[model samples]
Target: MRGEFAHLGDLPEKQVCHECIGEKYLSGQIEVEGIPATCDYCAEIETPCLSIVEIAGRVQTAIEQHYSMTPDGPDDYQSAWLRDKESDYNWEREGEPVQGVVAELLCAADCIAADILELLSDRFDCRRPGDPDEGETEFAHTSFYELKAHSHRDWDRKWQRLEVALKNEVRFFNQEVLDVLKSVFNNLHQMQFRTLDVAVVQVGPSTALEALYRAREFQSSLDLKKALESPVGELGPPPGKYARAGRMNASGISVFYGSEQAHSALSEIRPVVGSNVVVAKFSIIRPLHLLDLRALKTISFKGSLFDPSYAEEKQRIGFLSTLTDRLTVPVMPGEQEREYLTTQAVADYLAGMSEPELDGILFPSVQDGKGVNVVLFHKAALVEPLAKTGRKVVSASIEDIDYEFDVRHPEYEINTETIEELGGSVPMLPLFFDFDAHLESLRQPEHREPSLRLELESIEVHDIKAVVLQTTVLPVRVTPQRQHRAGHTESGEPKF
Candidate 1:
């Protein structure tokens, strides 16, 4: 391989797809196997590096303290991973037992966590790293470690052990460790063994930029002393540390977090876009700090634009004085999204607008930017395909997939999810501060200061009403011209 080495001089500078720009798992290609290829990202996404480094340093200091006095173990979170490595090596590496010592300390720190798991396995194999490659199976690495838990009680016990192990394993303590532990805990605490069958939930890069923008808008010149005055509500740390799951693309949400890692990420083209920015939106759609909303400068909505009340509730229980302009939105549709416009077709038909004009057309009620406006498509507006692909059961899990709705759906459209169906998973939906709905009613074009008396839940509770509309003025009067739309059928299309 040394003889076949190729420096930067040997390869043509391959370009990443335009859409892959500003990603943590960046684009830009290298000659692998002597061929150029365009593929998906190959690196884990980024977050606050300084914060991670700080936490790691803290762990090391804590370990030293415990080692000096007595062999106290690591945090259960940390021990589960590192303890075994300690047990396995237990001796020196590279003429020094530091790696082994680190492992032992990890086990000691998480002794309590190990007690909780109390799992033991009969299969313990001591082999070099090359003996256990992950290419064999999805659960190969997991099963290899878990096989030691033969004496474990149940699935829960094994999972708990897994958590500790992930945390303890020094290698797992990296960014990848954070990602894995978060996933493992979420699954254990929420679905148990269930899969997310409804929504293709993912965080995108755009989410990061939007969040930073919000933080910038909120903090014009407020100092940290002034911002953290309140733990949550009108003043605080800010919710920009979380994931926003709006109808926006997954990349948007991910970029939001990646941007936080460093100012010089290849995925982020904008520098110093915003600092210490806080964001609050309709839902915790992506990921963010989950400690408490009261600690951050955040706000959320209860319903959508179609609720006939979003604009009215802009100021109730929210940090309004810190408000800034909404961020610029890209016009391209999201990945795996299929929806039609509600009124753009009518506008195009009458005005004979071009495709770009049609795509940019706003609804009648919101064209003026007078109030809160969300894009809602009328079934007639979209060009539906003639042949059906597959059945999508939206109504099946309406309440369960609400985070997606808070991100994408028209605010008024009931997402058709239910808490009861979730079994025991905590729903990650936004809280609709009710007073905001009534607050704007006071302005009614006459600054009347409407009575802010109702609970937020009472504002726009659309308790699943089934209705059928019948209109005598049919579409039979219209005739189509030949174009890209000829393949569409005359019949109506069903959209989610």
Candidate 2:
């Protein structure tokens, strides 16, 4: 999931897609070689076990009518059984199966995505009174049931802005918000609404939103609803999702396929793995409502090179900086690059230059497919010192695993309760998820302390948290310059 081909390492440069020459596809696999122009989802030939994920979409109509009218509502429940399979890992985790592979990847699979799209199309058609857009595929997956396929990328961009606002509101009314969230977690099991991995809600104005939780556990969703019935005190309806049935457990690293050109997503992956969140998938694009930075850190990424057709600009050289600490993005290893800068030549060049904050060296690691083999050698010079001093250099070596089981337990549903709770009546803009910030919160718990950090940011959401990444960036310091002020200026400048 890195960017398009640059060609410097063991792997060959990737071939540009026929339809979109700028957007390159993989040319080599660890064992499987020569990838065709087919899309990854469509290309996977082996039939994988299908896992269905149905979450609550937007409920525009009244709850009673909405609930009663929808044919496939709760009462028309289809049993989601966990079958024993010969897959590598047991999805149910109960025990071993003999022949079939347990479903592991939920939404990543094309089959599952296609099936869910079909199911959503039906739900929205009935949920909304006059919405003909219900049958559309992209609409079914959007946070609000109206996003079109061509507009998805734009919708995502708009969503990030909304995410920031929802988080910002946390500073205003947190405890009351936490109470509602806690209620969702406490009664989720009893409500018989067990497996929800993803939930979507609308962002707008709502004077009064009444929802109920009906099950053996809680008497009504309104049981706790009355606690904040008054709009004066209900400062929340925080624009994004609040919590999940078990989101923290499932959160992990996700490097999106397209958004690599502008932003290099080398997100830290400590929070999900460190704190132990069950992952929804390898990458969480538009994951649960909130900006789960902890989960974002576990991922790394690079943007796809644009279609060569769009790359009309000529004579432009792009350079990618350091990747991971262990990575070494070597130059193209052919004799040509070697001749340009011999070891002696490079040494002579360096000797003439002053030691200006030498963090590490850059070297080419591999040349796979048509993609560039750009890698960074973080702390390259420090390795020898630490090794000589008997200190350890920590790194995780990547090894390919044959994934077989499909993740099916927790499913992403269109959560109406969450939407109405978030204040959709009064149209609120979408939000951008700050996953990196969330991961950082895990490190400095003090920053996310509801009372402390929330007070500063006015964030009072229950379980106010973040993942804090503590990396040693060499901050070069110098003595502060003295400001000369008289009747001059407030900044200590001399006023003439």
Candidate 3:
């Protein structure tokens, strides 16, 4: 083994001890294979260590596995690769001194660092050091080893393919598109399981206690009062037949859309001035498994650089960081039917998944940048009936109930005085008017369990006086040019 590293000729036989190494994993490796010897860099007596030659060889192998040599200069036809005003391309490199690399992996001493660099010179390339005139060493300053992390090219191509397939090639029953989505989301699901806290959020009355606000614009006060009377039925997710296509759901597919902020919900409905907007707060009843897309923006994966799938995992993470924006990008009016297909498919697929089943998605609100929005799947979108009773209804039943609205405070006051008498003497009790049980009795076999409970007191009616618009203004410059005649130059020469 000594003869194999002849390039390390005349270097001290003293071992580079594990105590001198900075990288934990590399130091651990050295500790396992080391024998008791004097350390060359730290001058430690009888320390666990490996020789300079051995350490350099290990580093060379690891670098070969994780890095690639960058091109020295731009090709003849590829001028774009060259940096502006430079003869050689300003390629990305480990922009650190030879000593720096050694310090990062080993000790930051000149003698041992120079020895390691000399031994690996044939296997590595580096940037020329600063001029001696500028008080700098003649040795190389930076290593030309590029880390082999995956790039956006692969993920971008796959996304484009899927987008095209969904919008143009095959909108429905496309196995290829489905398979691609499955691969992406399955990886995401696995990542969520690995990082439970950041990816999956628990929303319920006892857990995070998330209060979601939903708003509807009404043409008249009459319609607003009707919605106020039955907030669960009117303000919750609409029936399937009345459902319209949205960012996360296709037409006829009912889903819950709510915002963390009341203003955000009101803005989403786009109510005009002088229009009536009814806003209601809904509480999460049972525990919900919501995938937090906002968290995905900052989510990361930790793995060994030497792992074979490390680069791929990095790519997947990079893609996920940008996925929230892709899913929530606002589509222009009339173009939503086509633009929403990809996100709609994603929501549908996530809803159908059984393993690590997701009830909904929590994403950044597009209408209100500072707020967040939630879209619960049809299965988890059912709003619990406002009225309920623990006791079973026997024979007593409510004939009628008077509903009064407080215009000043914007609250609904249900009057039970109009309740009819069951047997002239025995008045119909309020306990017999169990809305939940009645709804359950009338529920179809396929009806899903309710997940949200509307807080009747949280209802609000807003008269839109003004709307503040947040926008970015781009200047349009009109440059005047001398108009050239058809097939003629600016100087009016013969057309060529």
Candidate 4:
């Protein structure tokens, strides 16, 4: 072993102990069965030690396994001819000095012997300060050393396959695709849990987002009062039969689409000029587990370079970072059905997850960048009844038998003096109707207890006179070409 590396330099006979080595892995090996002797590196009296020559070989093995030499050639070579014309062939060879690499492997500590590093540098054919052809070079040996690129080609291919599959191939009922999604999302969920402070967010009655806005557009000729009096059935998500295909739901599937901001709700409706838009706020009454796609844009992954799973984890992090754009890119008017298939499939997958049981997805609005859009699955889309009172009225009736009806306003002093004069006890008026039963009769058996409540007082009616559009204008250059009629000549020759 010593003869093999004799050409490098004089082999250091000094015995260096494991304590002199800064790297944990290498030091552990030396500590196991190394002979007890004086350590020349650290100048210790007696310790578990190995010859510097043996340590040098171990360092070389680690470097070869984990790192590679960066190419020193000019990156922007114009052509093969230009590369061939160059006299310097330095680019053909790669790698930094083995001395610097050894230092890095041992963590650049003073306890590491300089002699062992010098010996390794001579044995390894590395780019150094002095060479036969070149006297000296500006490049430092450390600059040329780089950790080898992780082998993640399989993941890249899989991601590409998924993109193609979602776009043109099988989108539904593909076990292969589902398996991939299961793996990816499982890992993502685990990562989110590890960083609970910044990942998935919870929204409910207690959160800052207690309510969300939903808007509906109608013809200006519609009665504003009647629209205002519309029940939750009309104001909330439409029934399955009336549900239209949207970004997150297919036709015939009902899902509640709402926004954190009123403007976002109005923007999503895209009401035409001279139309009426009624916006209502719905209070969230139940705990909603939501995956915030916006947070993916800023989330990061940190792992050790030595870890075998680091590459895969890093790749997953990268995919998640771009996931928002992949799902939210604007689709053209006629291409919506085709373009929405991918997002719809994703939505369905997310809704089906039971491990964490997500209620909905919160994403940035394509219609309004500053606005956030929420899409609750069918399970979470039910709206709570407007009436919360416990009173039960049996029947309702008018006093007079006259056909005419009269409406009037009553005034009263509501202070303590007036209340005291009236004995503070007012008799209950006769019940005119069974309000509770009437509401119960109107409820649909197919729907369950509402997770959301309609805020009647928050409803607003807007008459849209004009629509403001923000657009990016690109200059178009038009070129004119003369047209020629195709006809045979007088002699039956081809015409020009």
Best by TM-score: 3
For residues 306-381, write the lDDT of model 3, one tens digit per residue: 3456677778788887888999898898898899999999999898888778999999888777888899998898
Better of 2 and 4 by lDDT: 4
Question: Relative to the true structure, how large is the alpha-carbon lDDT of every model?
Answer: 0.25, 0.23, 0.72, 0.70
**lDDT of model 1, residue 378:** 18
Model 2 misplaced stretches (Cα beyond 4 Å): 1-50, 54-113, 123-496
TM-scores of all candidate predictions against the true structure: 0.14, 0.14, 0.68, 0.65
- Assess candidate 4 and give its TM-score to the true structure: 0.65
lDDT of 1 by residue, 113-157 (tens): 122121111012224566863232211112211111112133334
Give the distance in Å from residue 214's predicted Cα in candidate 3 to where it truly belongs.
1.2
**Where does candidate 3 clash, by residue pair?**
none
Per-candidate total of colliding backbone pairs: 67, 98, 0, 4
lDDT of 2: 0.23
Which is the better candidate, 1 or 4, if ranked by lDDT?
4
Q: Considering summed lDDT, which 10 consecutive residues are worst modelled in model 3? A: 389-398
Worst 10 residues of 4 by lDDT: 409-418
After TM-score superposition, the amount by which residue 97's alpha carbon in candidate 2 deviates from its true location, in angstroms, is 38
> lDDT value for candidate 1?
0.25
